[model samples]
Target: MATATYQNGSLSAASLQGFVLVGFGGGAQAQALLFAVFLAMYVVSVLGNLTMIVLITRDARLHSPMYFFLKNLSFVDLCYSSVIAPNALANFLSSSKVISFEACATQFFFFSLLGTTEGFLLAVMAYDRFMAICSPLRYPVTMCPMVCAQLALGTYCGGCLNSIVQTSLTFQLPFCSSNRIDHFYCDVLPLLRLACSDTTLNELVMFGICGLIIVSTTLVVLISYGYIIVTILRMRSRSGRHKLFSTCGSHMTAVSLFYGTVFVMYAQPGAVASMEQGKVVSVFYTLVIPMLNPLIYSLRNKDVKDALKRLGQRHSLVRDGSQ
Candidate 1:
């Protein structure tokens, strides 16, 4: 049984200590509005990602390295949004934003894992594009089936390993005082702030590992794009250049949106955690990006558009033949 102590008419305890007074820093109306917005995003995100998965699986033409990575990206977006959107919606509806300690830890764990995986996977995709465009002759052998599989597996493993370090460090803190988390979800920064124990070690580990991963991946992506631009610039024929540009434009836009939001939200630690700004930034990266990824990729890709049209046409032709 959990013990409750009364302090100034507020019930508190060390056991369910973190589940005390809901969110200490937000209004009910605001929470409800935010919830509604995210609910729509969650719906779209799920449907869009599912559609991509179905399209890719059914379309034999999309069995190449590029589409394989895209399928994985869609799957990741589904899981990434699912981790937070449901709990966020629940928090908005319920009077208590109280999540159990174990639940909070689990949420943080998976969120960290998925987020890291996405960062690395995007970089891997950039490298794959680099190889395809900058070295078209070697694209086949360079990005072979086995190599693609290994890259995807490595991305997942890297994310999981980083998350294990972060989650373990986060939970190791001793909570002797206030337990109210300022944010809707159990984010590392906010959760660390609530710890009565010294968080220097945790912060160090968090910063060191996450910083290395983000910085290294960003650098690699930049260099890869640099080579790609040079290659594009070297093409003699205007039509050829235009064709290459069109092929890569959709992917470039996706990368820009994904990396831009993440870099803006997490690349720095300014007045965000203390003020309302962090929440807004978090919304972009956590909620909005996932929702937009599928739309951006599918709507922009020629292959996907063609596949959809073909699927519809094939269905219609079959029906007519049957008639």
Candidate 2:
């Protein structure tokens, strides 16, 4: 809502109509190269997530609670990649690299929404694994269709609330100092750095909310896995142990990637780093992780691979028949 004002070659708060995203610094060729790289990543990530969603939905074999959550996670990754990747790619090729106030706010909202939703969804998936491994007899009753739907709905609602609070608080601050966002996107920390007013309260609230979400969800996952580990140790069958580990391994890999980058970004708020360093780390979570998720799941899980193979065969048969 900040309007741009210019006076005698000077930019003022009134003149702040939009923000300049200082994405990356390089010559024309370098930027073009970066553009190509990011575009390829974006394409791959979108296609991979979409494929996962379609496979999960179409395959009746994947109708369980685990795949139900996996499908939702893939959808979140699809949207999450979109919230930042396309804009960043365009900025890589654009001269001005300017984003309107509305666009910035919108991007921040959906980015936070999907990120928060994914966090909670991961924790829920962890619980699902724990139930299956530890309480296999009661798993069906515990994680019924209604329960799974409710859990998914809860994550979406939680994400919306978190996004509303964070986005509203962030944009409420008076950004009189400058409109240059050092990082690639309109993230909390980068935007906070641009505010002229005292941001101690904002910082505290942001930290508290983010900490609560991350710490609480992480604790749930850890506790779930702890019980799972115990159960695995007690199991008599070696094949059973291997199967459970394989199923859990993919989820653990995703959790590690997501939580590792998030903790680095938010845990040490006092640790100062270069904008370029922040950008690199952000790229890992925002872009790289999403793209890696489907690969991790499919390559590790035989069920998904089998599903893909079946789908491929069906498509080939249909094509041959049509010809």
Candidate 3:
């Protein structure tokens, strides 16, 4: 049992050492099955993102603002997937499922940092598309290399600031009751349910901050896409319109997969018992989205395919020379 104290006429855990993560419970067979499934996904996500990063860095053809932002996005997806997968995968096989306060906070921190940054990066990508399609003449000067670096930096900054607030606010609450987190990993909603005292401030902060980030970034995407659609329609060449549409379509698919779950997870009252349903939503964004992003972009994008082909040919030539 966790040690507790009564302060301000309420219960609080003065010496709450840690929490027990009550992961998705099941039989041995089920656990093994889940473990295999998640392990495969984690491997694919890591490999795919790493390949995208290497290809973008190695290929001169991908040295553009679009690919620059994409490289950063891949980096985020890679780390974001890392923050939770290994621990959860281990727990699936091990009997001990305990996590200390500090460890959980660290997990929450990086997850929040990278995930939030991705939203901003996606919005920036939408704006990049808008400028490239709508204002072809000044696209280069407007989205110069230095400018892309600054934008990427800004996304990280935004995510860091939000994460600071979220981590501090969520972890500050006193956990007086059971120290069980009913989720696969440390998450805001599940942890909030464990707070012993009134969590009015926590609720408001979570609601307000989540709303601000999601709404603002989503607005940028929507407005940028609005102009992109108009510009694409005005293009005379069917081939040109089709190419532009195809590229923009990939971004839209990723955005929908990401924001749809976030809106459902954080946009509502996290304290509600029903929010437990967000497990599926959380899995999609954290696991499935990262694994699918590289596929969506590489398969749908002609440039990425060409770069892969070129990279393969170079490898083959080196092998033949060695022989």
TM, every model:
0.89, 0.95, 0.95
Clashes of each: 0, 5, 0
Candidate 3: RMSD to truth:
1.9
**Residue 84 shift from truth in candidate 3, angstroms:** 0.9
Ranking by TM-score: 3, 2, 1
The segments of candidate 1 whose C-alpha lies over 4 angstroms from its true place after superposition are: 4-29, 271-275, 315-323
Ten-residue stretch with the least lDDT total in model 2: 6-15
TM-score of 2: 0.95
Q: What is the C-alpha RMSD of each candidate to the true structure, in Å?
A: 3.5, 2.3, 1.9
lDDT (tens digit, per residue) of candidate 1 on 1-323: 24545444433223444443244245877777777788999999999899889889999998988888888988988999889889888878887567877788889999999999998888888898899989899999999999999999999999999999998887776654566776767788777766666788887787677678879998888898889889999989897777667767766777777777666555555535453566667777777888888788777677899988988898999999999
- Candidate 3: regions farther than 4 A off: 1-14, 270-276
Q: Rate the local accuracy (lDDT) of all candidates.
A: 0.79, 0.90, 0.89
Could you tell me how far off, in angstroms, the CA of residue 257 lies in candidate 3 after the best superposition? 0.5
Q: Tens-digit lDDT track for model 2 on 195-312? A: 7778898888877888888899999999999999999989999988897899899999999999888877775676437778888888888989999999999999999999999999
Candidate 1, residue 187: Cα displacement in angstroms equals: 0.6
Name the better of 1 and 2 by lDDT: 2
In model 2, the runs with Cα more than 4 Å from the true position are 1-3, 6-15
Q: Return the clash pairs for model 3, or none.
A: none
